[model samples]
Target chain A: MTDTVMTEKSELPVHMRRAEFDPVPELAELRDGPAIARIHTVVGSQAWLVTRYADVREVLGDQQRFSHARFLERRPPGMADLSDEEIAQARAGNLLAQDPPDHTRLRRFLIPEFTVRRMKRLEPRIREVVDENLDAMEKEGPPADLVANFALPVPSLVICELLGVPYVDRAEFQARSNRMLDLSVPPKERTRIARESRAYMAKLVAKAQAEPGEDILGMLVREHGDDLTTDELIGIASLLLIAGHETTANMLGLGTLALLKHPDQLALVRDHPEAVEPAVEELLRWLSIVHSGIPRVTTTEVEIAGQKIGPGELVVLALPAANRDPALLPDPERLDVTRGEMGHMAFGHGIHHCLGAPLARMEMRIAFPALLQRFPTLRAAGTEPGFRSFNVIYGLTSLEVAW
Target chain B: MVSDEQLLRVRADRDVCIGAGMCVLTAGAVFDQDDDGVVAVLDETPEDIDAVRRAVANCPSGALSISTGTPAGA
Candidate 1:
């Protein structure tokens, strides 16, 4: 594979080129050419892009053969816009970026709190959160942004409650989180936001320590005690806060938008409440929000789909591409809520699968129907909705809906 | 309260589990890790239907289940 160098198009990070992915069809055309192609990232870094379904899954499933933490040690291609300190903060070891032993240790501290049983107890509250947001949208009436009103708030509120942070300061968290993820922001600004979030989380954790609440932070403080350092607590809390809300928020907005566009499927979900289970699976597949699966670095020489990848090469498992692979799901592009999509990679496959998936599914199952039932005439404000420009996630910037 | 026979049966192939700990966090009574940090089944049949459902939902490895009667829990 020959390396092709190209000038950077815009100052924006490589991750922000979602609209330019129109070449995805062309990328697919070359899928079989070289399973491991050396391509220039939007930031001009040389990285290996794994395109096909089998290879993508291979990279994600084999932690022994591949490592996630190594990518953080150096500046990731698209993150060139980040300052050294910003990159350092962003690369800090949270569950998503770690592997094996350390990954196991950090993840154990969180398992008890994220349990299905716990999330089940949180379901009614999640519904309440959805309802309150929807109620506010109703009061505001027509041409309301689902992203700001319904989509963003429900998950944000739920995560805040789960982490024991007062929802009163949610606006601060939301602002900082959004800026932290913004590829267009200056590196220093992003770094500042990252530090601010950690500090905010540290304060929140301290509060939970002094007077324990029913949240995850309280549980960690009570169980791990000195075993959990303040930085670790902040790291864990920040990771959850970001992952818990950002992904679900996008799914809720995008999934609802998809349903509204496909009335028959919307009718199916609205008619049969029990269908929420299967519908959620289909929505996850259709939306495929975690645009690409998390990145992994090869630890050893491995052959995936008959193509050999050497150690130290970066591998990105494209979940969106995999979920839609014709080999796995028939008519992969169609959004069929009742379709048998049991094993789609929407929440990912194997270890490192989305931990908050149950809560996410619960939120959507309740949010979508409640949304439709609450406003029978609910429809997008216009023909086209604004979308966020990011490759890691497919998000609606503003989904204005009116009854 | 759901009977053990009515509860869901969720099991993960211990060999494939990478210890993401999603199940334990989502449903502790149903899933726990052994001293080796591998996921171990605590209750093949959960007593609460809600808990069983939650257990199934939280299994990141997709190693948990819910019973539909007949064979009465996997």
Candidate 2:
């Protein structure tokens, strides 16, 4: 197969470029062809975009050819003066930033903590968290911004309990994570937030080291302290904290909006509690809260979809497009909760697939039903609740609803 | 939900399971989970064969499988 490199320096839109609920039309058009297409990065660089469902599995599965570390090494365009120490500090501990051996090792320690059985213990607590927030939403009455009162707090409180972060510190951590992920923020400001967030996590790491509670961070400190570093602990905690809340919170907000827009579907979820699990699955696939996947770099000459992508070229997978690929299922665009499981990439795939998937799934299954059941007459309060397209995680910033 | 007419048998590879809960979610009557989230086959012959088959296919870890009691080369 011949290489389809985009050597031209013309202005191409970023792969993640999208509207409120869908990928831009151009991405679907790209799926028409084979192998690859050109897409711009957030930092004004070009990379090969893989849109098909099968090809995505190939790339994410073959970590030997596609290196996560090389992808992390690509700095934003403006960061010309970052010291090597600062660079290492920033990348340390985040599982998405590491490749095999390191990625394998870190994930092994985390697997047990996220197993379905382990999450079951937290299910009752998750129910309590969902009910507590619903209580507040009830006290606040109709016309509440679901994003603030219901969507955000459920995951925030759950993750805080899991990682041993103080619930009181959520406002601070959420602010830092939001700024850290927002592309519109100046790169320098984002970097500053990254540093501050790490510093804050470092203090928590220190405390965990001293007291060693039963939380995830403390478990690492007690069991794997010799095996892991302070920086690694901080990195793992920071990644889990940001990821644990942001992805689910957005799914809750966006999924609620999607269901409200289609009240027939919402009724299925509200009336039949058994329907809630599959509804959550369909929502994760349809909404696809994570718009663009974490980019991967080709470590060696690799052929994907019949295109010979050379070593070191960046490969961006359009996850929203791939999940909606017609080959995966019939009538890919339709949202049917009865459609058991679509095997979507919403929680991603391969060795680096979201470690917290079971936890995320449980949280959504519990939260969505409880929220819908509590406010049976819930409807959109305003015409325009905004979307978080600019942030790394796609979600509604605020969703106003009235009961 | 298991019946005498059905010949399907379900088995789980616990070590290979990542506990995505896809199996339990897909075939709730036939499959449940342990405290560690590894799948436990409560019933081998589920009344809903299609849901059980889909659960096997959708296991990201490929931990679940099915077998039928038939001669190999019949």
Each model's TM-score? 0.82, 0.88
For candidate 1, write residues A1-403 as lDDT tens digits: 5323232545322222344212245344445355445555444455666656666766666778878788767775444566786555554447787776777677766765655555677788888887898889999978788899999998898888888878899889888877766556665666567678877887887887898777788888888867876667777888888888788888888888888888988888888887777898888876677656566788888776566778988766656566666766677767788874346677776568776776787787788899888888888886478777643466787788888
DockQ of each: 0.18, 0.29
The residue-by-residue lDDT of candidate 2 on A84-168, one tens digit each, is: 7877877888899998678767876777788766788899999999999999999997779999999999999999999999999
- Model 1 CA deviation exceeding 4 Å by range: A1-23, A32-36, A75-93, B1-74
| TM-score attained by model 2 | 0.88
C-alpha lDDT of residue A345 in model 2: 83
Itemize residue pairs with steric clashes in candidate 2.
Answer: A117-B35, A117-B37
Candidate 2, which segments miss by more than 4 Å at Cα? A1-14, A340-342, B1-56, B61-74
